[model samples]
Target: MITIERVSQVPEDFLVDNPEGGAFYRAYGRAGIPDFELGCFIVKRASRPVTTAPFFIMKLPLNTMMPPGFLKTLLGRIALRVAFVGHPSADVGRIQGEQSAEVLELINSELRKLAPLVSYKGFDGSLGLAKFNKVIGLPVPVLNLPPDYWNRLKHKVRTDLKRKLKASAGLRLLETDGLPKEHLQRVYELYRQTCDNADIQFEQLNVAYFRESAPLSKYVLYFEGDLLIGFHQLLCSKQIMYCKYIGMDYGKSRQYKLYFALMLQAINICIRDGIRQIDFGVTSYAFKRHVGSEMHQTFNYFQHRNAWVNALLKRLSFLLEPDESELR
Candidate 1:
């Protein structure tokens, strides 16, 4: 018989298979993000552990992709109490078990007890394992570069990248295994500012997470003369560089095209390290595409405990999809 249990936390050995996502669960755990109540689900088959997944309870906005107006604002304020099936602490949701379809459906049946809305996020779009309610996710962008990358790109592409780099010519670069303690507060402030200015909002990371997660991340720091202007966090695998998060002083971002310069810098870093691909994660569609990054499709599976609402969501799922242009 299969059984499921919900716990406030997991043992240290949970999800040990993917060590490459260093400090991920530690930094983005139960107490990591604001307004998130992380739920750890332990699924056992015949009393043997099969999967340990992180879920969350939060208020999810109903009005996405709507124009900025009274209708949007009114609907935005009206959120649903949602129970998410994957790790809600990060941009993508991951549930590790390597479970078969039958096991996944069993797990799903158990999780539906949590709230009106239950969704599994950050899975590859190709994995249509279950025929549950499906929402197409924002495309994940990545840059695949080879040796002599600059020379291989079209002439116009090279010229544009060069111009962007020239704006930040005076800035100095510092690459470190982790952020120094002395610079934590400033970097955290920049992170907050970036989140505040963003057009879409999700779970917000706290400074506590940044401080604790500092040691496991690879940082690319930007210094404008003596002043620090920006920094980006990366988690690297053998051949792929996951550009996870970034922080920047927006006051100087336009002055030096800081974000663009940072991407150029990341490209250089990837080339130097022989990292073949740069996974820029999601969002910032225009700039990502301009840099020759291709979008990889992902999906979120959801359902509502109420039969009527579940049917309603299926009908209105179109409102939750990414624009066709963003898919490019």
Candidate 2:
């Protein structure tokens, strides 16, 4: 037997303790926006000493550009590929729960039934419980640096870094415990523009999000002669620095290279704090690869908890494979 429940139904303690669940909730909870479910999915097996997997929902739950039914079709496609999709490296810490073999089949079928409506690279149900018990396609560049080592970065990358440092000499990059009320709107505006330029619908954040996150995080922003041109946010785990959010003025891409410099700055901060690795987040950008960031596999897993659906997914796999495309 299998069981599913809304995220609210899950107890608070579990979400608090499980890092994966917490991250998922924070990212999709629209930064605490009201009326948005952000649609979290939890699965459990109803057998002896029943087991469960971490609560999961669509990775990019909001795609304003896509048609309303697109995600549903995508999710269905992912269900068909659950058995083959790899694990996500970005989500290192996951909530621990009982894994269900029976539920996998059920999920497969349900996904196929909804094929025309959702989209995903793979299903969290199938991939999460397998090798990593997590999604396996998030491309986070993890770096382990040696002591006093600015020597390891590629030469071109180093040269570019030098240029950025020289260009932004007048603008000081200081660690502020928090932003002033006046500066808050400016920062938020830049952030919103950055998201819009990329056609990404980021969860709208109020002043509280910035106020709360800035002090707790080691973030970097670039100001050119008193004008803020760039900003990036990062989270420091004991040995890992997770690159949370990034934004920069579009025109500065070539001249300033603020994004690349921001990453290097993060690395330098990591070295000072004794951080061993950096999780660059999901996408594989050119700069990430240029700096010798290793590509670790991550995956989405899914299982439809219905008998007929499972058989249908299996039968539809071949026909659906060509239609399958990555979420990014």
- Global lDDT scores for all candidate models: 0.76, 0.50
Residue 183, model 2: Cα distance from true site in angstroms: 3.3
Model 2 agreement with the true structure over 266-317: per-residue lDDT tens digits? 8778788887777776543566666656765534333344546645644543
Residue pairs of candidate 1 with colliding backbone atoms:
none
Question: What lDDT score is found at residue 130 in candidate 2?
Answer: 31
Off by over 4 Å in 2: 1-5, 9-30, 33-36, 39-95, 103-138, 154-157, 177-182, 199-216, 251-254, 301-328
Expressed as tens digits, the lDDT of each residue in 1-328 for candidate 1 is: 8887888765567645443342467666733677778767788889998877777788888765554567668888778877776665455667666566766776667667767777877776554455578888877788998888888888998899899989988889898888888788888888888888765666688888777776667888899887788988887655877787788999999898888887788888889989898888788888888878887777887878788998998998876675554454
State the RMSD for candidate 1: 2.4
Best model per TM-score: 1
